[model samples]
Target: MAITREEVLHVARLARLSMSPAEADKMREQLDNILAYIRQLDRLDTADVVPTSHAVEMGTPFRDDSVHPFEEKEEILKNAPDREGDFFRVPRIIED
Candidate 1:
């Protein structure tokens, strides 16, 4: 499909662009070339192409799910700058 001068002017106005008379002609030609390329692409045969969700096959690796408690809490808390009893204490965060 070929884009018209009126179409370019209307689109430019909608996009809030201050296009001069020379710019409108240049934009019309550029848009027409892009549309012509799309028209050419549309003529390609893609009937045998299979639709795929992913470019490559995907799967999660097998792993046994397990839960465990910390063996030495005091040893880990020794590196903290601030601590309150059995837990680490930090400054409060206020989002504006």
Candidate 2:
């Protein structure tokens, strides 16, 4: 499919972009090339092909959740500039 210069200008206006005549011409060419590539891809035979979210096979990247209790409570709390018992004290932001 060939992209028109007017269509490119219309898209630019919709996107709130200020395009010069030269820039619009360039954009029109690039969009035309992309559409041509898509048209080329449409000629492929994919009757036996499976639709997938990714191009390659993917496995779950996440590990099984395992709870591990933290041991150094006092040692960690020692770094706090201000603490109220086991919690860090911060200035009250909301008046309730």
Candidate 3:
């Protein structure tokens, strides 16, 4: 597929890019080459090949989730500038 100057200009407009005539010509050539490479891939015979998301097999390496209570609540609250009972007091942002 040969990309034209008009197609390049349209793409540039959609992308909100300002290109000179020389830049558009250069982009047209580059885009045409990329399309030609993809056209070459269309000629491949992969009827028996299975579709895969990744080139290599992979698995999630995540650990099991576990919960625990804080050992020292008073120690943690000591760092807060403003506190009320067991929680830190923050300034009210929204008027009800």
lDDT winner: 3
Candidate 3 lDDT at 80 equals 96
Tens-digit per-residue lDDT, 1-96, candidate 2: 498999999989999999899999999999999999888867889888888788778787996799888999999899989999999988889978
- Weakest 10 consecutive residues of candidate 2 by summed lDDT: 51-60
Task: State in Å the error of residue 43, model 2.
Answer: 0.8
Q: Locate the minimum summed-lDDT window of 10 residues in model 3.
A: 60-69
RMSD in angstroms between candidate 2 and the native structure over all alpha carbons: 10.6
- Write model 1 residue lDDT over 1-96, tens digit each, in one string: 498999999998899898999999999999999898888867868788777778887796786787687899889999999999988888888888
lDDT of each: 0.88, 0.89, 0.90
User: Using TM-score as the measure, what is the rank order of every candidate, best first?
Assistant: 3, 2, 1
lDDT of prediction 1? 0.88
lDDT of 3 by residue, 4-94 (tens): 8999999999999999999999999999999998888678888988887888788868866986878998999999999999989988899
Candidate 1 regions off by >4 Å?
Answer: 45-96
Clashing pairs in 1: none
